[model samples]
Target: MSQKLTLEQIQNFEGKYPKQLWHLFMVEMWERFCFYGMRGVLAIFMVDQLGLTDANSNLKYGAIQAFVYAFTFVGGIFADKILGFKQSLIFGGLFMIFGNLLIGINPKEFFYIGITLSIIGTGFFKPNISSMVGMLYKDNDARRDAGFSLFYSGINIGALLGGILCVHLGKTYGWSYAFLAAGVVMILGVAMFLKFKNELGPIGDSPLLNIAPKTRKLRELGVLIGSLLCIPFIYMMIQNTDYTDIFMYTIGPLAVVYFIYQLIKIPDSNAKSKFLAAFILIAFSILFFAIFEQAGGSLALFAKGNIHPSVFGISMDPNVVNNGANSLFVIIFAPILGLIWIWLSKKNKEPNTVIKFGLGFLFLAGGYYIFYTMRFFSDAQGLSSLEVFSLAYLVVTISELCLSPIGLSMVTKLSPKHLGGMMMGLWFLASAYGQYIGGKMGASMSVTKENATLIDKMLAYTGGYKELALYSLIAGLILILVSPLIRKLMREVK
Candidate 1:
């Protein structure tokens, strides 16, 4: 009989990455294809097909996204306490497939129902996978950041493909085809995980391994059934939007209280300090994503109504460019930036994690300012330059490179082993707040006047972007000013 691989052996591998990372990467890529594909279509589908006002679509989009990330916190706790990562991922994937299939059947009628299921599935799937990747490296592994960087690239590859394909399919073929494509690719991702999961050895195995087999199976079954039962409640909440607001307001404070409870349970003072630093970073991330998330909300509408259809001399779909451009830029530039970080680190000049995060906000400010500048390039028709819009995405991609992957690494590095899943969940939960606020911001930018001209929209949206740029600048400065305290709390983690 073959000896099972141990976690120690996996972490002690020679070379830049463990082979298992690639398998996870492929799984994540396909899942992201499903995720980003659905995300790229949600607001536009509501406005174009369901006849929602742009403001309502943006608000609904925010609520949906907020629910998605909030559930990750719930899902993470479930995985940590009961199901384990593997079962959570499989169960989540199944829910996502069914959700998309439901929407494909009748988009306008089933949109909320389908979206509710996808939210639950994404909640279960997203955080656990990243936590598992963190498990691949030892504490204090220098290559950990690099591993996450590579994994991030995999995410964008899936995003780029799904973003382009889903929007194109929805526009040219039909909404049914677009949603069905997302479902099919998700099925492939789940199947791929099932086939190769053994390569992960004991990494994501059930926490109930010590219990009786029948009991374990029953518990897992219960979670699956329980999640399905929440669909109707979620459906109703999504439809009302008011319920969404109430939920968001309640959840944030409750999560902070729970985090504090957890923090008090830890035995080490240094660990507690590190957790505080993580919390601070997580708080700042809310501001970053609030500005960044406009791509799926206000920017989607902006692309459809105001941006020119050509990039340089090449004619293309504006929605496609809006959906996929950032991912493409990330795929092309992430590795180059990763290498640059390595080169700088060799000479001991690489910025610390806190500074990197601060720089992300600075870059975000620059990107949004560029977005504001698009108004200057507009003609009498309010059709602005797509080339300049694409240029803004490129700068936004740089900001993402500076902060996001590093944030993932920082959470793992700072968190205790037992709290791994929850800390990662908290990171995404912060994103939930960002998405929630972003929706409101998008709605505020929406032109509501009946028979409003495109120029009116251009002015409103660009004016909003200018305000966002200023807010980003202030946040970046504050983060940079506070970096020293955070770095001290981090101690030897870096």
Candidate 2:
């Protein structure tokens, strides 16, 4: 608006956030509580409620998540290109509210709807909110990373709590109650957002809306209403989970092609540099996610079936016991991780995005290797649950620290305006693919203990985990070695 506003002015806004950023942070925290809580229990619910085999249910959970991440980009694009970020976020949040409500009503009937709502909803809200936070600062705003870290921490608080909430609700009350709880939390998140619209204070508004005349605004609203009406048909195409691959292939390519077209169209001065660097990073990020995501799906079951929970005095259910290490790790480490970056920043040692990612996968490698190293124990235990509960999750969190938070921030930091949302979609596609692989891998490991020797079945499961971990380890090493070149390609950070 006024010379694009200096970075200093923006930082000042973060400081002066008309109504303490706490409101925004807490709302997101609780919503995450709902979402992650639902996730914590989703696979279990499918197995326990829907009567799907444990392997089958976990695959379904993973597949749905992959698709949801993929759509985050779509949400980003529609907001950036058409609806603007705030509107898109609002739309997505509302959609999520409805989706959760429907899930509560009858998840079996509206399973896809609930899941699709989350995908589309996250697409809109996730990227833009971060972008909006970014806009509150000027270029190279020193506090920017800290702000994100704080916001990122809010998300995990929910996730940590979710381990307890969804598990308890789903186990004791019913799966429907769990979904209903998730729905109410979502609605509260939306309400908190609407209440604080003024605090965002025009940051997330459609730029087009700002420029257009009153008549034009009304016309745009009319068009939006028409589009909203068309959602049912869109739902039809998205309904069949069986066509998941077709959706992944089709939507991903379309988003990419559209991004290429945008790269060709925009006059962002640094467009070529931005496109190349972002594209490479996006490509690699997918690989990072593909394997790292085994934590929740295949790995979850592994923890449930293989790991023993009762160690000292306290006896706990495997479901809760399984997710325990992750909850603890995230709670303890997230702040420390943020502080490390800050410490690094002061010394100019803060790694660039590419290297951060490479490190993320390296962490992935390290984490899975922990699993491999513990293979001896698992082998000895003959698939005892203890090995998985204590060892597997501990390893996964380190990897998650590497990939997850950084993944969110990178999308906001690197992606160009026109294709930011689409690139996010591509980023998610990587996760989707990883999840699909995780499922396929998990499904393959179902060699019946009845059919094979106990040693043989144990070998089958451990073998796959070790192989995947080793593969990720090598990939991480390669990324670290080449990080300098990748960093150079980012072309002297914005």
Itemize residue pairs with steric clashes in candidate 2.
7-138, 72-123, 73-425, 290-434, 306-384, 306-385, 307-385, 307-386, 308-385, 308-386
Tell me the whole-model lDDT of each prediction, alpha carbons only.
0.92, 0.66
**Error at 212, model 2, angstroms:** 4.7
Best by lDDT: 1
Q: After superposing candidate 2, which stretches have Cα over 4 Å from the reference?
A: 1-9, 13-21, 211-241, 268-271, 373-375, 378-388, 448-458
lDDT of 2 by residue, 234-276 (tens): 4654444466656666766777677678777767656566566
lDDT per residue, candidate 1, 200-295, as tens digits?
888888788999999988888888888978888889889989999999999999999999999999999999999988999999999999999999
lDDT, candidate 2, residue 240?
42
- The 10-residue segment of model 1 with minimum total lDDT is 337-346
Off by over 4 Å in 1: none
Give residue 361's error in model 2 in angstroms. Answer: 1.4
